[model samples]
Target: MSAAQLVLDLALTVRHDGRGGVADDLEDAEGLTAWVAAHTAELAEAAALPDPLAPFTADPAALTAVRDLRRAVRTLFARAVRPAPPSPADAERLLPADEALDRLAAAAARVPVAPRLTWPEPGPAELTYRPAAPAPPVDLLVSGLARAAAAFLASDDRDRLRACHAPRCVRYFLKEHPRQEWCKPSCGNRARVARHQRRHRADAL
Candidate 1:
């Protein structure tokens, strides 16, 4: 997936109220590890890192750090999607993006990158690329996710970012279609149903 999509995917793992609510998937290190394991393929493809499983650091502290970064990214994306300023409480979270990016840059610096030539697809498909030395898995993961966010934030598509407004929803989606408002058909239906219920209540009062 593209960097934007990657970051978006990471930001979307846990629901808006997921930390302590019913949909919280990153509530603990175990859950966070599971989530990382599940996305190994996607993460590997995006980062071009060797050994897809290598990026999942076994350190408990690393797991906690990634979880923290994920939440920080989600907070940034949520703000980007909003039409107005976030509440003062929400505004407090705006600093995460910077911090996460700084951490990623530091982690990335330690990877010791060098340019190398290789033939990717047999005949006549030679290309040069910068390859990095083996480093802690968490570092690569952080760098990849941070790059995704940085790319997305710098792109024009950031304006198209939207958070599902459906009741009890916390998913973020890119506006693929001009008429696309909700993330999925179910959310649209739920939103319509909610509107109808509100109208009915107001009419009967």
Candidate 2:
């Protein structure tokens, strides 16, 4: 997946609970740990991690840090799609744009990495980044997420970023087509049903 996808995935961790409420996928340490493991490849690619498939376990502190980053990411996501309303998850309590940008930048700087040049006999030379200092995997994960989010926000792909306002969904999705509305088919179904209901109620009155 592209780096922008990784950022969208992080923001989407907060989603509808199926019972008509919002839910956090990383609500606890176990959840965070599992989420990290499931998306290791994306994290590694986005963060340029040393080991592409190394296992990662998140602790309570890591969970807290990730949630904080999530807040900043979501807040910026809200701003990226202007004129349109933001996701309902925390629209009223979103951090200021400046604060969110500062937090994201701070998290990304937590682990410094420098590019190293390398070449294989049959391949062109490429630069692979190496961390300048020893840091915990959790720290790398958070910084990687922040960096990916920042990159996405600054990219042209940000134009496709959208907030799915369908019913109970509180997700930020990348619009795949000009005609696309909701994040998924399920959300479209919900929105259509809601529109039908409103018309029916109007007819009843």
Candidate 3:
């Protein structure tokens, strides 16, 4: 997946609390822990973690940190989706996210990485890349997520970021097509059905 999509997806794992006006899954540590575990493989790949560490341990502090980061990301996206220009208050509200991002960036920079040659299907051409050594699980996860979000926001692809329009689907998606509205077909159906029902009610009235 594209970095923009990955960042948006991470923000979305909490779901239901944005424009959708639904329940929050990351309301507590347990929920956050489950989210981390569910997305472990992807997170591992993004962090460039070795296979032996297939699943990262989800501790309480990590859960708290992740949930907090997710909230900041969501807030930033929310502001981006708003019709009006962001006021100073909006910037003030994003203080936590800003601070967290700075810290994560610093932590990521401090981590030591080694350059390694990688081959695709044992081909003649080898790719050289620097990969981080195993570090604190929380640090790795947070830095990776923050960097992804930072890069996405800084890229032109940020223009494609959109919040799902379905009534109860609190998802932010990278709009794949020009005409796509909802994040998925189920959400589109829900929105259409609701619109149809609303039309019926208007007719009855």
Candidate 4:
């Protein structure tokens, strides 16, 4: 894939602003670990590159390094996904990988791109817009991660982010208003109905 497409896919996989909060599905540490494994494989395949260690013959060492970097990213993802006591294995798995991703991100920032117009010019304006260079891969990845983290960290009551409280719905959302609940109202209604039915059954007894 082209560099742009790889960047876009990485953003989608890491941030996951889909109709449903697929990111939240991998809520716990183990889930996060599993998610990284699954997504890394998909990404590598989508890029049409051979295993991270193959297809880049100019520098076999660099290919191995990139593969290790990817592994590190997976480790960070697992840590971010879970909230649990850290074990020795988890610590060992995480630190080097996290450092590698950070370094890789820094290096990726050096790749340049041509600037494009942000908006169409009005008539006779001479198209006087100068585009800025594109951000490095590290910046894109980090920025996307920040957005996703904010969505998860912000509270629903604060009018920032939200998670569907329905038993059957596992989605996260950005609430448009203070009272907003689920990504869709139907999910909220279903949850309410389920709650009501449970209460009524208990009352009948």
What lDDT would each prediction earn against the true structure? 0.66, 0.87, 0.65, 0.40
Candidate 2, which segments miss by more than 4 Å at Cα? none
For all predicted structures, in order, the TM-scores are 0.77, 0.94, 0.70, 0.34
What lDDT is reached at residue 123 by model 2?
95
Note the residue pairs that clash in candidate 1: none
Candidate 1, 138-205: lDDT as tens digits: 66666666655666777898887887767666677788999998888988998899999999999999
Per-residue lDDT tens digits for candidate 2, residues 144-182, read: 888888888999999999999899888889999999999
Worst 10 residues of 2 by lDDT: 46-55
Best by TM-score: 2
Model 4: how far residue 68 lies from native, Å: 13
TM-score of 3: 0.70
Model 4, which residues run further than 4 Å from truth? 1-159
Quality of model 3 by C-alpha lDDT = 0.65
Tens digits of per-residue lDDT for model 3, 1-205: 5557667667766456545355566666677666667766665555444454446666778777776676667667766666633322233445455665565466455445566776678577654333466667676667667766767777887777777767667577777899988778998999899999999999999
Model 4: how far residue 181 lies from native, Å: 1.6
lDDT of 1: 0.66
Best-to-worst ranking by TM-score: 2, 1, 3, 4
